[model samples]
Target: MLQQKSKLAHFFKSASVIKILPIALLIIAIFNSYFIVNEGHVGVVKRFGEAKDQQNPGLHFKIPFIETVEMIEVRTRKNAEKMASSTKEQMPVTVEVSVNWTVNKEAALDLFKRYGGLTQFEQRILDPRFRSATKDTIPQFEAEQLIQDRASAIQGIEHRLAEEMEGFPVIVDNIQIENIILPQKYINSIEIKQTEKNLAAAEEHKLERQRLEALRAVNTADARAKGILKVAEAEAQSILLKGKAEAQAIEAKAKALKNNPLIVKLTEAQAWDGRLPMTMMGESVMPIMDIRNANESN
Candidate 1:
């Protein structure tokens, strides 16, 4: 009986370890089943290598061995790339591009099923498609047009990329053409051409100003000549009028003298001094005697 009791105690001790081991394993499995899905992320539940369900942020439970969860970020993402391409003029150019994108929430299952992950999706679809679209669109513009009309080129690229990326699980929110790099030779040539054009415009403006000045000087000189001519003509007319008046006055005086001969004697008497002339010969004295009598009578 003593030996049996000792064997029973040993058996109980062994059974106790076995029971505790299963409970500990069950606790571990329960802990592993429950997981926290963080904010900005969605949990994709896969069962037997197939997507079965999706879970939002917080605590979630699933079959331990048969089910697994993958957290996919559904936030906006940014990517930048530089591509080398040629223009219509066959000039080599470097185009830097920035893309803002996001994975569509409703399409997350399709995305996971199709590409397995964001990295694969970008590598297989987004990057190659973007580069191809840019290369295809760039050759439509010349180097000069590409530089001068950059907005148009950027819009074209964005539109083409959007078209190509259609039906994909990713949404391209915006595309930006950050920078364009032309060859050094082309840059130098463009600078020189611009400088020459500016110089030509300045020269043309200067010539126009000089022509206006010359026209103004000519007009001024013509006005001065006309004034001088007008003054000379007026002076000549005044001189002619004075000469005609003087001649008329002289003719009138001559007519008056002819009509009255006594006027000349009166003019001579007024001019003579109060004195008598002396006789020189005998005949002159006889004539002088009449003059002396006339004087005594006066």
Candidate 2:
């Protein structure tokens, strides 16, 4: 009977130890599975399907059975989508859109818990929402707008997507319309429209150039007029100086004439040089006489 009791005690002790063994192993496993959140990534923690907290880029720990941690990448991610839709004017068009986005690190836990976990968030919420939003927004814009005002359309869609994905805890940094695919008809039409616009712009530029040229001509004419006035003023000043010199010379000459009476006679005698003309009456000719010598003889 004592041997049976001893055997029963040994069995009970072994059973209790066995029961605790799995728990200890599980604790060891949890501690061993420590993860490091990489740069630009956040880790999400959950306790029995309930969100607990988010972990930044570093070492982190969690309980073995009562708590579990799932690392979710919150880094910037890029996605591309191509879509075909009808415009507001019922024009069929195709487009390719590229999106740059990142999961919000601060709302990692809330994102995992509230939105049916990470898988569901991507599959159910993000994909469908993106398709639907792109379809709705593209159809509201014209094909020409899709081609010409692409940046504006992209901005509008990005804003709307940011609002739609608000609760999903994803931030859309930029949404770019990479390519606008259209039928040949639409392409031809757009090309023609662009050509016409370019022609109009060219004409406007020509008119502007002509206007500038005309203004330049007017300025040149004004400058020429000023130059002519300056030249005329300089010539008038030179002529006045010449006139003054001539007047002074005439006054000096008159003063000399008043001071010397024989001056006129002397000038007359000087005017009669050796080239004296012979006097002729009919056929008879007389030799020229020297009036100064005759006057001296008289």
Candidate 3:
């Protein structure tokens, strides 16, 4: 029960405060007056509905009931839209372009003077200039180039856009192309062409690999054949050298035999065996010996 009474009292207090707020505001407005410019926004002061001065974000003194303040945002804002245009090939194309822009703080008064308001600044001046820039730049590129080298086309569009808004109070920060819608027939053809190119490249790579393998096999066979030939040549050379050495030894022996004719008798004496001939020599048998060299030595 106490909690219910406390809640009722709080509700009545809030109601009284809401009722007293308007009268307090009216008295304050009649006596003292000031304007507060918000962050990222600039205040445009007007006297008798004429542009007077511009104020930065802070509190500023103003005459009551005589002066008014208009706020315009100076912060960056993004706008994206699908811009339709034709290419040099006369093919219709649609592209989404996003633009980041901001209004100058110092030019707030001029923007107010010429455009009157934010709606007029965007609808009357900004939109027309953007459309003109887009139409002027896009038609210069071919449809194929727009699909293949889309970056270049987007860069050209951005440059032309910046040029169109050069002398205005609006600043273009950045521009990006989000999407491009090409014809279905062109897309299909491109995919087919890419697939064919990939297949051709694969076939060429396979042929190159086979050629390299064949070259390696040929090199290995040639190396084996050369190695066998080298071994055969080495063996033939060794046999020839051995035959020459043997012939040289035989020639030396022939020369010695030519100089010493008694070598034959010595060899015969040495070969003679101490035994009687196979004749009936009986018990008086004596061994036949060649003693010619014995007499010569004596």
Q: Which of 1 and 3 is ahead in lDDT?
A: 1
In candidate 1, the residue pairs with backbone N, CA or C atoms under 3 Å apart (3 or more residues apart, or in different chains) clash, namely: none
Task: Give the Å shift of residue 290 in candidate 3.
Answer: 25
Q: Please estimate how well model 2 matches the true structure, expressed as its whole-model Cα lDDT.
A: 0.81
lDDT of 3 by residue, 143-210 (tens): 77877787887788788888878888888867777887878997898789989999999999999999
Ranking by lDDT: 1, 3, 2
lDDT of 1: 0.88
TM-score between model 3 and native: 0.59
Off by more than 4 A, model 1: 1-20, 196-298
Error of 3 at 109 (Å): 2.1
lDDT of 1 by residue, 140-232 (tens): 999989888888888888889999999998889677878889989899999999899999999999999999999999999999999999999
lDDT of each: 0.88, 0.81, 0.84
User: CA shift at 185, candidate 3, in angstroms?
Assistant: 2.2
lDDT, candidate 2, 1-298, per-residue tens: 9999999999999999999999999878877567677887677777787778888999877775667767777777777788888887998878888777777778877777777565677677776777777887888788887877888788778777877887567787677888888889879988999999999999999999999999999999999999999999999999999999999999999898889989977877889977655543455476555476778899
TM-score of each: 0.60, 0.63, 0.59
